[model samples]
Target: MTKVLLAGESWMTHSIHVKGFDSFTTSAYHEGGTEMIAAMRAAGLDVTYQPAHIAADHFPLSAEALAAYDVVILSDIGANTLLMPDRTFARSEPTPNRLRLIADFVKGGGGLLMVGGYLTFQGIEGKAAYAGTPVDDVLPVALMTRDDRSERPEGVVPAIVNGAHPVMAGLTEWPTFLGYNRSMLREDATLLAEVDGDPFIAVRTVGSGRSAIFASDCGPHWGPPAFLAWPGYGPLWANLCNWLAG
Candidate 1:
């Protein structure tokens, strides 16, 4: 089985409510990758998911730790989470730069896949801010320096441009997506699908490893329920993981 470590795709929300002259605060935690993880696991891949808060402290800190998994996936998580762990942010202690570690891991023949969201690739208001990081160099696309989201409420359907690629195997028709992160395809990368004149799915070989980008969320609000229910969903993810693991 392909060993995969997926970081992010979970968030916590805090809200205040007012009724009459009283106010109350509420907090909730949510995961957006439940279906995606199940789909990958059903395909026989061993997936270890680390939500945003957990990943801030628990994401791999060394090449040896990263080597335990064939692929590392970053989705809906900002660079700061991995960059400033507790030791570095709170204790004023020097810590391993996880972004650089991931970059080296890819160069050392590991696989990397970045799925887009509000906090993935140069996200909303540029808060995701992955443009100039070490991990940016390892991605198949060049991220913008500012906010890169393309809102397509009218529904944008991705078109297959590289049907022959292994990642597209058994995937013929694709459902519409609500939005996606816009990125420039790197010169050395292969584009598998495209939407709104941007690279929707792109892949590249980095040193002895491989890297790919899925320019949208694995679930809503960028990925709609229709897409999650699409018959090709499971096969698409499986094929991509297998191709990357190889």
Candidate 2:
């Protein structure tokens, strides 16, 4: 079994209001890490999900902890969560930095996958700025801006750029993305998919490890409806996971 470590914020409260109504209410939201883990496991991979509800100043906690997984996944979380000012940004002693540790892990042969969201790769309003961090150097593509986010309607579609790659093997065409954060590709990056010429999916190899960036939300509300409802969703993510682990 391929050991995979999945990390992200699991709980969220969103403010929503009825259409054309002024009244608003708060709704709960959870990250898609668990869903992806389940899908991967169903496809025959060993997945261990480690969700961080609060930000940590130091990364990985321990080198021993970092060595336990073959792949790590970051979805829908900001940089501050992994690189807080101190071990306790609110109040605590400074300790090991998890972001730096993650970079080292990748450099030492651990695969990484970064999924898009309101808080990933210079997310909405520049909240999840990851441009200058150690994590950036390992990613396949460069972020567009620390503050810009683009949205596509329900019917908007994504085009495949590298149809022959293993990641795109079984997936010839994907359904429309309800929306995605916009990003640009590095000249050396391998473009896998695009939307209106902008890179939607990209992959690259760093050291003995592999990295992939999916510049779109993989959960409800932000991801394409077809992604969750489509029959191929499981295989699509599974293949990506396998590629990353390799």
In terms of lDDT, which candidate is strongest? 1
Per-candidate Cα lDDT values, in order, are 0.94, 0.76
Per-residue accuracy of model 2 over 121-160 as CA lDDT, tens digit each = 8888888888778888888878756674677664567798
- Cα-lDDT of candidate 1: 0.94
Candidate 2, residue 40: how far the Cα is off, in Å = 1.3
Query: What lDDT does candidate 2 reach at residue 59?
Result: 32
Per-candidate TM equals 0.98, 0.87
Cα error of candidate 2 at position 121, Å: 0.8
Count the clashes in each prediction.
Answer: 0, 5
Candidate 2, pairs of clashing residues: 58-96, 58-97, 58-98, 59-97, 59-98
Error of 1 at 35 (Å): 0.6
How does candidate 2 score on lDDT? 0.76
Deviating ranges (above 4 Å) for candidate 1: none
1-246: candidate 1 lDDT, tens digit per residue: 899999999998999999999999999999999999999999999999999999999999999999999999999999999999999999999999999999999988999999999999999999998999999999999999999999999999999899999999899778899999999999999999999679999999999999999999999999999999999999978888888888
